[model samples]
Target chain A: MKTYSIVLLLCLLTPYLGNAQENFIFKKAYDLKVLGRVSEDTSHFQRIDSADLQNLPPAVQRYAKFSAGMNVVFKTDSKSIKIHWKLKKMNTLWNMPSVAVNGIDLYGWNGQEWQYISSGRPNSEDNQMIMVENLDGKMRNYRIFLPIYAEVKDLEIGVLEKTTLSPPDTALVPSSKIAIYGSSITQGIAASRPGMAYPSILSRRLDFDFINLGFSGSGKMELPIADLLAKIPAQLYILDCVPNTLPEQVKDRAYPLITRLRMLKPEIPIIMVESVKREISNWNSAMYTRVNGQNDEYRKTFDKLVAEGYQNIYYISTSELMGDDHEATVDGTHLTDLGFMRISKTIERYIKDSIAPLQ
Target chain B: MKTYSIVLLLCLLTPYLGNAQENFIFKKAYDLKVLGRVSEDTSHFQRIDSADLQNLPPAVQRYAKFSAGMNVVFKTDSKSIKIHWKLKKMNTLWNMPSVAVNGIDLYGWNGQEWQYISSGRPNSEDNQMIMVENLDGKMRNYRIFLPIYAEVKDLEIGVLEKTTLSPPDTALVPSSKIAIYGSSITQGIAASRPGMAYPSILSRRLDFDFINLGFSGSGKMELPIADLLAKIPAQLYILDCVPNTLPEQVKDRAYPLITRLRMLKPEIPIIMVESVKREISNWNSAMYTRVNGQNDEYRKTFDKLVAEGYQNIYYISTSELMGDDHEATVDGTHLTDLGFMRISKTIERYIKDSIAPLQ
Candidate 1:
């Protein structure tokens, strides 16, 4: 009977093991948490308020204002893990809140119930670190319940699987970042959801980091803002502020902005983008005129840069990017989700073929 | 003295004729007129309320509340122009009003003062046309205004000068249009201004008619939407809905959606976009796992389509698109305007090299 039981257990484990092998082993899982606090004190929660859930999707809406303290679950399969978290405190005027994690809530669950483990707030600057020997081999799920005062703007949950057991010495290093300075369209005004934004979409596709400085109507390529941009560390800098500016502004700002960014990070790739064609009557006659003027200015800048021996700068024409399709835009000025995808793919290829080679 | 005066007049005329050769012509202009009615009648104005303007940059905030009796002006020169105009009525609903030339505030300087020639609505669909003669010869600034019930969203003005005039029939035609579909990032959410969006930037560079269809969070690859897409005529269709869908959803819908669109337009180009990398703790481990699974399924579908002898289907990998920059995202998920510009430029090159050949 014992032998038969052992064989049966092995038989059952075969499928599970096969699935484990087939599962693409992502980076070793880590205990990732985010903590924040409201800038000020607030009343206790009684029940999940519908109004609080307004912005969330239906799946997570009901849990918006949990009164009895809700348990947040995260799944992972690693014996050791690292935690990266952020703690923010909001003020009265600014509703943004910070979340916190207590030592009691960090627990290791044996199959039946969650077993309390150790926890503490991480150093503010060194928010990420590794853990060892705390996890069991069983599918581990990390759960945390908040004090109902904090709001989580961004959170990440990952598991450390052991196909690769050793963690890198420098784990959780910041990913390479691409920075775009542009107008309203970059701000994600019309996209259906936050995650669906093209930048978000591109991030997922390319496995990199991004910074969106898309001020809705504020991408004027002014010197002040360009000064701010010069402070950032980026692998690529994209300058596309011509749509909102008049031709004179385009002529005035385009070259200087490009030159400024290049001056700051001489080797970093700089791409100057012109505006897309708007859906207006007499599509060809009028649209091309403005486009050409902008491009001419850009070209002149590019030529100057080239003459000055700058080699890393590039220019992307609008016609090829938009492909003369009128339906891609929701309004004449903004792109629909479809338009973003098309442009993202085109960008993806360019980065791979052109930029990636340099990297 | 009389002979000297005649010579002076002739000399002035000679310079005027020479100046005509160097002016920029306003090839075609489209005037978008808004008729004001009671705030209750929202149908007349494509109403965009204050809330809609909430996300827009300061420049466009005033124009967010588009009510009836608001006149919006859009114009194009031989190079670039504004194509689409969306407005909000006083009641807080967004509306798209028909644009006409007659309603434009046309003014001509009668030697002493700038007099209003006409302020009546023009028949846009019928006899809607504005032609400027000898505009390039003299440096003249033309302004178009749209008065919204609340405030103005955008005002576009173009300068026309005298130049070699090409007959209207000789005007250049838009070679093709690239239709992009995706999410909020594609829609230019959170960007400082409208024109800064990557699509707009890319459009300005390439000089193609751009149709932006980026809904905030609604790019789910649903058949109902696909049905609507099938009706439109386009040279290229870029499918970028992955950011808005889960891996299972992508597997289930991607192939079908591509196939459906292909069925409608057999020869049109269709490009499938993968999602961008998210700055999750695991660096897109889980999302990538899901994306790869979906991509595999999509590739298989593409193979099947090819086997069935379908052409013009392409895939753009995300890795090549974003380069090594991961910090370009504002959050881990969404991109800053800087990121959009980089992505747009990258895509612009890809489309130019790949699709331009076919075109």
Candidate 2:
């Protein structure tokens, strides 16, 4: 009877309560458990080490500063979530959506898998938006993926004042990670949001973390990039740079880059991915010949390495990469969220087979 | 011997020839066979009639002017194709890619299916881009889907000089069409490109044209819209406006709209689609309740109409609309290309079964 009266009193006062923002307690996202990063010394949410910028290409250095695949993980019992983030600049790409380039994507762990909650829409450089509201106030695990192609200055998460907000008590993420190195597609150019990138999708499905070393328009299998990648420790490495590299460049550089990486990280596995067929190649004979030539060169290099007895090296072909229908990309070159899902599904099996024994 | 000499001569001169655009004859897109439009009285590419704007809601009138699912069909033997278009104004949505909003999507008839070729990327109000080059100079059928959410002032298509460029002689598109009416998702919001929208996707796969009457934020099942939809002659009609209508609004407005449409277009099939489950509803209590309530109300209205002896009315549940995974949308609300694919595939079977007898 006493509980009934309290419920009745709460129901009566529910109409009078207004402006939920006034009841929130804001916390810096930096204090939370961060994932999808290799280095922790950086003050901001950048993917690459700033100290190594001098050795990298100009485009790589600039692309590295953008938070491509970094995300924050925490558990909260707040009825609502509000996110406020400051981007260094409003860097909206022509082909990609602003939500993917600068906005924040939120996901919640629903016992079985991480389900999408909502997105924080970015209207300006300094933007604040509510992710979700009027929840049941139950303790839930949440991860918020940062901007895919924008430099984040700072971020804060707001929850109800009375609710508890803290890091995970159990092991939600694995200690070892899968590091991917590739071009603009890997950098999440045309994904609807950051979390929809192939690496992020694979991470969520496989319950692992991925260090995305994707440099936009600069994943050309350069020796400097190879040197940098070899230094970052990981369970496996994915090289998807054939799209950006010319056929001659592939034939010239694939051997040196693979040999150097294999020499440095002998115990780890490296999976070489062939570039997916460009959609325009269906009609345009030039793209068809060019892409096929690039893939042929890449395959020959992979076969040569296999012949040389590289034990830990693996190869992933482009047959089932983006499916039979070539409607996976926005432009003929870059993968959309649909393409990302197909690629992630295709690559997930290879990742699982390679990493199981090591894990 | 003569063919071999000609081939050798062409190969020799290939290196010297520069700027392929210089050897092209430009033709206005309006002269070609236009598809996915109901009225051709308008001077430009528009889905809806300007004469009907006074009867629509203010937002609907504004949205109707945009070329959402319109396309031009032409046959060309040119080695390359170039497109130049002028937009009334640049209308780039934050969540949607500009390629989808303002750019053109090209597809080719590859015997069995319409395969993706390339997309013309939009940069500004006046934009010109090369769609493809270096083809085999074979006679090929092509369709270029117009911008999904931008107004086209004028459009021109260019083909190589001394090559045949004309409209399709064969019936590439059927005279009878499938007309769809819905909210922003149906209006092609957040798709990777214009061709990736559900109606456009279905049209290609089903081998039929579709009149897209999707209005952003204005598909409220208004009496005026039903009156307008009833007048358009088509093989079938689809009502997918549950996402934009309130539960009470569905209960109040749905019966009147459906009855009016059925009364006017007595022979055509009317498919009522339930609102797709929003991704945010998985966690947000308010959205969960609201969306479920709206669907329930919509379903109940359909059941009532069925019980009252409506013969040609059909109902489609939200069972497999966007798949089980909630990654189909950029936000929790609007669909991405992945979501559009899922929706199109799910709805295709129902459309095929309904329109088969009529055809």
Identify the leading candidate in terms of DockQ.
2
Candidate 1 structure quality by residue, lDDT tens digits, A180-252:
6665455443332232345544544553444554544446677655555565556777676655555566678
Q: Supply every candidate's count of residue pairs whose N, Cα or C atoms clash at under 3 angstroms.
A: 187, 0
Model 2 Cα lDDT, one tens digit per residue, B1-359: 56643433332112112245366788988788888877866666888878877888998999888999898889999888888899998887888888899999988888787888888878899988778777788898888999989999998898988998898756686677888999888999879899998899988888677999998876989988877887777889999998877777788899999999889888889999998887766776655766687789999989999899997888899886989888998887788999999999888988988877865
Residue B240 lDDT in candidate 2: 94
lDDT of 1 at B110: 28
Model 1: residues >4 Å from true position, as ranges? A1-359, B1-175, B284-288, B291-296
DockQ for every model comes to: 0.02, 0.40
DockQ of 2: 0.40
What DockQ results for candidate 1?
0.02
Give the poorly placed runs of model 2, Cα more than 4 Å off. Answer: A1-20, B1-21
Residue A191: error of model 2 in Å? 0.1
